[model samples]
Target: MSDNLAINGGPKAITLKQEEALRWPILTEEDEQAVLSVMRRNETSLSEEPMKLEKEFAEYLGADYALAEINGTAALYAALFVLGIGPGDEVISPSYTYWASAMPAATLGAKVIFCEVYPDSLDLDVEDFKKKITPKTKAVIPVHLWGVPCEMDEIINIARNNNIAVIEDACHAHGAEYKGRKTGTLGDFGIFSFQASKNLPGGEGGMLITNNRDHLYKATTLGHYRRAAGLPEEYSKYQHTCLGFKHRMSPLHAAITRVQLKTLDEKNSIRKNNIEKLLKAIEELPGFHIYWPPPHINRVYYENDVVYRGEETGIPIERLIETLKAEGAIVRRDRYPLLHQQPYFIERGSNPEDLPVTREINEHVMALPTFPGDDGRLVEQYIGAFIKAARTF
Candidate 1:
């Protein structure tokens, strides 16, 4: 192994010529045409584009109903409101995820109970979740972190026994499946984000999907008055009968999303193959390990998480990340803090000790890029950079 580090003027690992940095909204001419078609018609809003996107999105997921929101946060809020989760209620969610999962609960005046996550799956630990449930527990949001599906069967069973609503926070798991079923459909309601960084990028938008007609009706009326269900006969046409928020999706976003949805499967396949090849190359190296999903999961790779067994390598994770970046691999630390310890939660009297595993996982986990159609040569360069950096660690 080379004694000199790249930071000290040694040769960098990534030497390939790649066109663009790895990220989302991997658009093509089709994506352009899709949005242009909507724009050219001057039907940018209050048009069929958003509704058409909803229909196509629902069909794509094999879901009974789908509705759009301005963003994932709005979708979550809408889900909670439609399900009657509010003040005095408690919502459980894993701590090792984006704060969006818990923010809705907090904003609803519901107590947010942050739970531990299984390190391998990065999902809520069933045992920990069970311990958090109380009569006040009205809902559980199991986040499918990094496109990995949670143990849905166990979670569903627990929620059913406790009579708690299960909402899958599938913002990162589009095109993913669990136990031969799509992830978003397994729960009472599922929320997905098509943020600029997501697998199926729609710039900034969200989708809520469910199988329950009642949920659909409530959800439609809750924030989407235009799509409200069961209007009274006495009500005039286009009259809003129910109270709702302005969380509707714009036609421009929906039009772009429709085209992006069509290419999701193919994009996911590319990401999966790229990740598999990269993992195979370096997973066996000392102190380097990758979590393999269970057979029942067909996960899409929105982000790549590499766990460094620092005790085994005798190197700090920060040092490793610095070395990888010096070697030309675009890498970074986890962006979100453990939910229980976040200032936003702590100021509201949250208990930091509620999630021990989450704290440990966040310490060693490193984020890697997993955008679709990543250059094969660049991927090889990344593997080389990772392996070389790991050796130094």
Candidate 2:
């Protein structure tokens, strides 16, 4: 089929990005300079500029090693394949995420099990996750949705007891921490998305991280690696260590991502501040809720992609989204339908009701803009417009 969906790239009514303060809503001068600098010198590929970025990213995340991949989807598939998940194996992940998160596992012949989110926090539902684990379960891919770290301590404990490997989908979370440990480091392995919309925007790139040497070796090997220094000559005698894919990130994307990583802390701080202002502005108004961060939670973010928190406002979310869009607010419904509900998964026999909480949130939730470079006044404008729409309709 054509990858021509307007959402992907077609004359998008409201471009994916907004411009303010003389900068694209999500990028900075440093981001541009870094990318151009790499191009000017003609350095490219994982062996050159991408390698430097990978090293810096690893150091910043305090992980033992980090490998850059073509995108988050590839990062996830590489991580799961190295863990030996396939055919009969099952991998659990929240249903409330982009399909890219689970499709990787599914493509590998592993059953992608959908888990429900904790109702109020919208983080992973730990209790439900425990009940779903079985002997066939090989891994758990917990997503720190929208920058909110799930209950990692509890989830990790469950994973440990079940002997199932954990690979966090930290795509939405960059600087997010849980109980002092960073999200990516909390699991046996983790992956982050550096897509244009992520906190660490790099256009299209991802990082797979781990402290385990064995996992590092396996991940790199399956991620299109030829023989390297660490392995003995005997290892290369085989065609390939395991199933592999061409998943390496280009040096250009990595160069830009490296610059974004350097400023991640500074940018994230502004995101948190912006979320708070948005929360305070819309909290008391009827037909709206911000799903504010919990006391123990410190990070929250926006998508620059607007979502109306009032799907149940008696105004169908679709209608409200249209009203907001008409006013220039890039609002839309939360697209995380239960993985089991998708035609692709169902045709393969997955069930839509498999994850109750996830399906519920998927039907009700929506995201709103939070990119740091956007004008704060726009958030207010949308909030006010939403309030008017809520009452008028």
Best-matching candidate per TM-score: 1
After superposition, candidate 1 runs with Cα above 4 Å error? 1-4, 19-23, 229-241
Q: Which ten residues in a row have the lowest lDDT in candidate 1?
A: 230-239
lDDT of 2 by residue, 1-393 (tens): 222323234232333335562143366688788778877887665347667877998888788888888898888888888888889999988777788888989999988877778766777789888988999999998888878888888888989999999899999888888776677888988899888878888889998999987777777667654533345543343335433567778888887888778778988887766656766766666556556656666664635322344544667777766665654565567666566788988988778667766665666666666647655655555556555555544
lDDT of 1 by residue, 204-230 (tens): 899999888777667667676766644
lDDT of each: 0.83, 0.73
- The regions of model 2 sitting more than 4 angstroms off are 1-18, 21-25, 226-243, 302-314, 390-393
10 residues in a row with least lDDT, candidate 2: 1-10
RMSD of each: 2.1, 6.6
Error of 2 at 231 (Å): 3.5
Displacement of the residue 305 alpha carbon in candidate 2, Å:
8.3
